[model samples]
Target: MGKLGGEMKALAKHCGGSHKTVNDCIHIVQRFDHHLLALNVHIQRVAQIKVRHIESYIHERLAQGIGKRTLQNEMASLRAVLQQAGRKQVAEHEWLTNKSLGLAGASRSGTRQAITPEHYHHVLETARMKDPGLAAALELARLMGLRSQEAVQSVQWIWGMGTGVGGMWRRCMGKFDSWLRASSGWSRLPPFTVSERLGGGGKYQAALPSPLQSKPESDRTNVEINERTCPE
Candidate 1:
């Protein structure tokens, strides 16, 4: 760890939360520290952080086109660290309020759009040529409707379990069993638990059809063939 990392780790010991929460807090704070360095403000310790630092960092992020919800999260992390550093009055500063920062209203609506089949396959094929591991991860994300991070973590988890590509495909098929049944006109389907290791806090039951059910048969078949041919 570098000097800043060591300082953050020590500061994290004072933040009361679960291991994951503390790590996440430190991650955001570290990102802010990067912004500080980029702006030529080189404060070495958490205790040295100031309200001016926070203001400058937020302005920099806004100029870089960061969204309001994300800035809100960064501010929350900074506030926690500042409070721990005996700067609790910073939280009451009028200029640091949500309204002053332009983060007070309801969150903007999501702009996510569905990826067309042609576009998805085109990208997947390119990834395969460059890196098979990336291709496998992309395939898993498509079939399981996972976010990119969750897909990569799932792949790592599979490797940790001593199961390679073949095992991953088998697991995918098992999860889709309920969807296949639902598509074949079944009235009911079984529930499956999403593992806590996949980024969420704990296991939860998902009793719906796999997102793959909405996809065409050709897309599903192509993925199956690719997985089978993928090297172990």
Candidate 2:
């Protein structure tokens, strides 16, 4: 396909199947187009995009305050839509899918300041004194490194037992510990964690449905009762 033709087709698919408005589609597609242009790629050949291209696109979008999950969803939707257009290869090579392009937000290289040991300890201790949810959340955030909403949404029912607080806590802590290195204040770095920004929602919790148990060491992803991996 010619340059204009490819743009037209991608735009058509994006508008009809994407956000449902030409205006929004234009913005999204234009952003996509701009990124491709910067990378010296064309719309028709977007299916040939590699993980590096996706990293650039994600870094651009993440700069706009789009949440990591939301960005993941957008990319996922885009990938599916592209696949329907026989462009699944584009999605397959994305940073999200391939885990290349080690971008960082609020990390050692990000613009945001890393949380200090004192601050981390403070949040943990304060939560311990006041709210168990807050305390559990702190462990998830400061220790387990769960995103705010993940920690919040993690409150659900478990099998054979009761709820999924332990399930959530275990997962959160496991992730936090895995990346021993400090996160740049807000960099969209690799091995993304589930975290809500500080002072955002500021409060979330769930009661222990049963006796909370730490996830098995072997089960690193903390696959346990009530722990659902976010749909990709």
Candidate 3:
């Protein structure tokens, strides 16, 4: 590994997160290779990266048709590694601070688009027929309001916080999309079934955990008619 690659490894080691997260940060930093070279900022002197370099990079990326969210992730990764390497000042440059600039969909004067109930049911039913695992994952996300990462991963709903209060306690290793930042759309409430699946075959009584923040304002009006809706 060169200086930049070695610094990324150093960052991964110090960050001490899931392998995927660390690797993603490293990858994001690596994506700047061509631009960094053009700026004559080599891997060994990556810590010397400055705001101008970042601005130039942003312009280059934007010129090349990079999307807002992708750029956000790349900037985040760059900041993380630089900060981890004791170059916190460099990572917090004004140019890199604002999240809204050039970000598509960053302006939301209009209401967010919500998923329809009919569509939710159809999708769930179709997924169930096609793949039980996917259906179960969708159900977990819809009913419990678990993030995609939390749903697909192995989770242990251990009863510990309170005697009867049930909450998601543990999340094991798994990769799932979280950029959605909202529940998959359930515009109208879906049928509620108190099934054995919740209690783990009657081993533990399942108590509904706190509602997920992912629920959009439109979906919160009706409690009985639970609608699964994703706000995109």
Candidate number achieving the greatest lDDT relative to the actual structure = 1
| Candidate 2 lDDT over residue span 4-96, tens digit each | 335534645554532234344445545666677776676455445555666778787778877665565456555554555666555566346
Please tell me which predicted candidate would have the highest TM-score against the true structure: 1
Q: What is the C-alpha lDDT of each candidate?
A: 0.61, 0.48, 0.56
10 residues in a row with least lDDT, candidate 2: 181-190
TM-score-better candidate, 1 vs 3:
1
TM-score-sorted candidate list, best first: 1, 3, 2
Window of ten residues with lowest summed lDDT in model 1: 180-189
Each candidate's clash count: 0, 23, 11
Where model 3 places Cα greater than 4 Å from the true spot, the runs are 12-26, 33-41, 50-52, 68-73, 92-112, 155-232
Question: Counting only residues 3 or more apart in sequence or on different chains, how many pairs clash (N, Cα, C under 3 Å) in candidate 1?
Answer: 0
Q: Which lDDT value does model 3 have at 103?
A: 50
lDDT against true structure, model 2:
0.48
Candidate 2 versus truth, CA RMSD in Å, comes to 13.8
Q: What is candidate 3's lDDT per residue for 177-221, written digit by digit as tens?
A: 122222232222223323244435434322333233465756544
- After TM-score superposition, the amount by which residue 46's alpha carbon in candidate 2 deviates from its true location, in angstroms, is 3.2
TM-score on alpha carbons, each prediction: 0.52, 0.32, 0.50
